[model samples]
Target chain A: MLNIAVIEDDKYYRKDIAGHLSRFGKVDEGKSLSDAITLFDARKYDIVFIDLNLSGKMEGLDVIKEAVKRKIPPIVITGYTSEKLVSRAYQLGCKHYYNKLDIQNSFEEQMAPFLRSLVYKQEDDIFSNSFVTRNNILIKNIKLVTEQMFLKNNKVFITGEKGVGKTTIAKFIHKFSTGSMDSFIHVDIPTLENNMIEPLLFGYKKGAFAGASDDFKGLIKQADKGTLFLDEISSLPPSLQKKIIKVVEDKQFYPLGSDQLIKSDFRFITSTNENVEGLIESERLRPDFYFMAKDVELIIPPLRERVEDVRPLVDHYINKSGTSLLVSNDSLKLLENYRWHDNVRELKKLIHSFCNCNTEMISLINLPEHVIENTIPSGQSTPLASVYTKGISNFIKKHGLKKLIETIEIESFKEFYEKNHFHYMNTLEELHISRTAGYRIKANIKKLDKERHLVH
Target chain B: MFTDKEKLLHDLNGNIVRLGSIFNILNKIENSKDQEISKNEMNQMLEDAEQTAILLNNDIKTFISINMNN
Candidate 1:
């Protein structure tokens, strides 16, 4: 039975709801908004039936707002059926709006469907397929594709930048594959570089190598009837790549220091940050292997494109790290606007730093000066303009010169100097400046540095 | 502010207790299988399981809401 809370000011209607709902489950009754809040805090209620027309200093809308703030969906039971109130109730996150006049008959009917929808909605909202993290639209898209691939027997090739979530995606595919979960095996090809490929793919007898002490089962044999995720597939040497192709296509490989051939069946999943097509063009990657694995190639997008997902990704990192670091809105805005060149790995490191600082909130002051300083044009020129102005002020404070006298016109010179720090000569060879002005500026900077040092 | 860890632990304990009670009832019914059990007994076992499941579901929902909000 669902634990329910009935919040109504009217004595008769409140009694009626409690009496009716008690038949379904345990019912907690509250006469006022404060009482409702207290009951909600004290107990875990599945559904909250709140009267929108509560008579008192406290309004029912306040209770609804509190519930919404707590991320709990409230059901509004009101005598007032105004369109304004209904729309407002929805805005306040009320999942069900019911007229109290028909509480006896229609209440259960309305609540039945609402509760069912709530369960499904909660599940959908929690585990959304469209959810992106750290602007990594590629990972989100890969997640969806991998889910689809899990149901079918298909070759999936994951490619992305190094330290991108390629390995994570490969593991996700293994975990979610339709095949038995225990059958999935992750094999790092780079680790097999020193060993003979055949022995790694097929089980080796004792003393197969100089130091072979015991017989070993290969990854392909162990991954039979499941997935064998090959990480850093590009690192496989040409000879190993050809052997891998043969194993993938012919389903057979010979063990090292042996002549007998062994057969095994396993689905192949490969990951590489490098461009396999480029490797094939360079004749480093075998054409047969590339063609065999080219059926479902998923190119993971970099993190810069999907800046909107940074907050939740940061939250996820913070949660996983068990850190109580709260990211301030402004600081989060800075993070979201940054061009995360290193993708999720870099963002995770930032979170680690924030956690290590042990600050309650990650403010702009706590962030690395460069991160806060380099706010990319987040499509909002006004904010960037303000930041630029602030940066110029800081620069001016550091450099105590009103303006540098230069050969170029003063107005254009100031703009160029403020923007590019007199680097126009580097960009344009003929853009001349007075040597005396440059010397004067250099002398002023040295003087300012000396003064700063003395003050510190 | 209550930490999410505390709330989750409290909810988990409550669910474990509820599920344990249902399991006990199921165990009792299985033990008494040799003696023809009445329909009412079977119905009670099913009802207990259903109630426990609902309680567990409610606890899970609460835990999720608390964690997400935090």
Candidate 2:
């Protein structure tokens, strides 16, 4: 039987709802907010019907908000209704709002569908899609897309910070979507060589280039009757944007250096870590191309916004690391507070490193030095240093180790100078450089400062 | 003088509970034995509605304030 909570102050109305609801399941009645909260803490309930106004106050709506925070959607029943109140209730994750006075017959007239859903516990709905997340917002968004857009083979665009699991969600959609076997094709645009992107996307004819050998089948054709996931789509060259738009529009494209067009039927899903709107405005991503898959855009929120997911993610990573260790609450708190610039991937790496150390129990001491040092105090942000470090790491990785020391020296010199009240001696001491080298560093800083000013 | 999410929520919840009482009074008037509402009863209903509106507005503002500060 379904477990239900009813929070209504009116004795007669509470009895009316409870009497009807009792026929289907156990009903717990709460005449006040405190009683409702106490009942909520005792155990989980399948559903909650919260009166929007209780006694002479709006405590019932507050109870509804609390239920939503616990990932339980509550049906709001109010004696009076206003647009703002209804909208707010929905925003708090309520699925149904009933004006108590609108009932023509018994409460069952308005509640039959909800009761049936609870009784059957159907798995066919979007909520059953196993995307491996506890975030209600993300779950709701995924459910909406799967229910409304997936079956129609509509193009989907997933965007979020790098390593925020956009590609995983795409794979999940592909797995559940009806399609041909071995049809999930993923093309990493950033990894594709600039000179060979076209040939990789569209097959090249023999002798198309000086070193061309045999004919090559492009990814589009290979993904026929299946899903093609274009990852980091924002990195795709502008020259190819129109061609991609054309392919999406017509489902047909000619191989490189060929006169005949080849038709291929495939579903398209694209993901990007870059700001697509900015890219479109700058003419980097074609407007038509962007709009082709814009109907079902899913933005996976950054980890920091969904902090509740952090503990489960950490547990998942630890379990995957194959280390039999329990993460302390303190360590989890530290991990949660640290800005996840690299998102889930970074958290996994941290857990993997801890496993490498073979620790029986992971605590605050096991956290990475940078993460520990950069953990922002509650309500205060100290982000610049860590963000700068991440930027420098990416720059070094992309540009090779050449001029590494000089880059570090210049950055450190500037950082210390700016942060230390422009103390020349302090900056020099921090860098372990003499006056001659210091003059060169100062010149470099001035040059960098002038370049930054000009760019702005 | 109230501060923090829990306190603010508590304050709003109290106001809404009071507002619910006003709604209950209006409901009683609407379902009274007489088929038609008297002018005095209608005026009382209107007054109750006004009070409910003020309380609801205060509750909404409190929620907005909490969101902004957070």
Candidate 3:
């Protein structure tokens, strides 16, 4: 049974929430922020319902932030909500923010399914398998390569850092390939013992060796008329790598202790987290094998390099987790700035760990200490700053540098005047310029403002 | 013209009543198994109710600010 928490300052509302939720699962009621915190710390709750203001104090938002950090998805039910407050709630990571006046009816109709999803989803398989991205050029290129490669039956060579979704993409290509069925077989090269590698890849005849008492069909034969995905291809023995290249070239291999050549038709999809050049130079990977494997080479970019995919991925994971908790913009900004060494796999685990926190929203405060420690702060040259820079660059491209500089000067002067409440002396003092220059800048700002008004 | 405290209070009470009745309608819609209201229509209704609640809340906040300053 799911454990749920309801935190509201209003006694009547608190009871109402508890009563409604109790029908679905165990309900823990809190009439204050302190109660909510204490209850949350005592045991794990699947979901938390929160109010922005509790007893005339907005400290409840803090409690919500904390809960979201812990991964407990929270729904905010409050009578006091404005455009600013709603946006703030989402930015802080609340799953759903509701006006208490409409919440009673909406809760049963809309929120029950959301609540059920949070508590009942047992697997992470619901997330969309297709690439989730905005404008990561590398991801777009890789996708184009996948589409290009899918047209032919050529062996695919995928390379990326561990957890960069190499296997996922391989599987996607397999499914997308024409005539794909239940015939997709995956073999982890590193897991097999050195002695078993040959026998596993190329079957063995009955009494092939002391342990080979019966005939065994290998992974290659099993993958006949389908796709064979070799994960961690870097771990394949050098001897076997040479042999497999021949089999891929001719689609024929001899079983152990047998003279008969086995002919099989299988599409090859191989992936590795190792640097191929380094492996080949070290003699761990045969050069001939590498040549045969690179029929269509696709490199999956690491998470940090593909930052555009993070927001959509976060949304995908959140939705797949079946939780109502919203991710705050601040948290997303931090996530985007983070160097995800483990890539999408690490991100999936991180989201899973925090989704258990019972809160209205996931805030920066809810983020992992390591993630928070590694992130670039807001005051720095952020991702948003780059977007603004691009916008400015576009303007400069369309217009000219001189016009851009003039506009910047006017805008800066206007900002300074506004900051000082239109006090000329204060603006001059801050700008460290003469009164005349300050007056001239102010006059320019007024003209620009008038022009802007006319354009609007 | 600025509304007097008495008029503001009256308006707030009326808004609350109106909001309560809307809630009642919403409750009936939710409880009915054969809900003829389309999802988009229901969403529109909810959005409308939320806007009214927000306007009322803003007015109350304005009144509180005014009284506090006074």
Q: What is the interface RMSD of each candidate, in Å?
A: 16.4, 7.9, 6.7
What candidate 2 gets wrong by more than 4 Å, as runs, is: A1-131, A179-182, A378-456, B1-70
Give the interface RMSD of candidate 1.
16.4
lDDT of 1 by residue, A1-456 (tens): 345788877554565566556544457788788898898787666678887656633378888987777766688876555576788889888887876654544656765565646544533443454233433455456545654564345788878886567776666555444322347788777777556655777778888888667787788888877778887777777787777887888887876766787787777788887777788888767788777776688777666556766887888889888977788889888898875656777788889877877878888777865465445656643323434455656645654335222111333333455467456454232336565655554566466446433522
Error of 1 at A171 (Å): 2.0
Q: What's the TM-score of candidate 1 when only chain A is evaluated?
A: 0.56
Compose the digit string of candidate 2's lDDT tens values, residues A297-409. 89999887678778988887777777787889888887888767678777777777778878888787766555754465556545434435456676567545654555566
Error at A293, model 3, angstroms: 0.6
lDDT of 3 by residue, A1-456 (tens): 356788876554565556567555557888787898898888677778888767657766887787887888888876554566777788888888876666565677766776656533511121234554454465456545554554445678899999888877777666544223338889988898989988988999999988998999988999997788889887898888888988988999899999998998888888889888888999888889888888888888888777788998888778788887688998998898776757898788778766766566778877765565445444544322332444777867865787666656665665677789778798879978898887777787678556533522
The better candidate by TM-score, 2 or 3, is 2
Docking tier of model 2: it is: incorrect
TM-score (C-alpha, index-matched) for candidate 1: 0.49
Better of 1 and 3 by TM-score: 1
Model 1, native contacts kept:
0.00
Better of 1 and 3 by lDDT: 3
lDDT per model, in order? 0.66, 0.73, 0.72
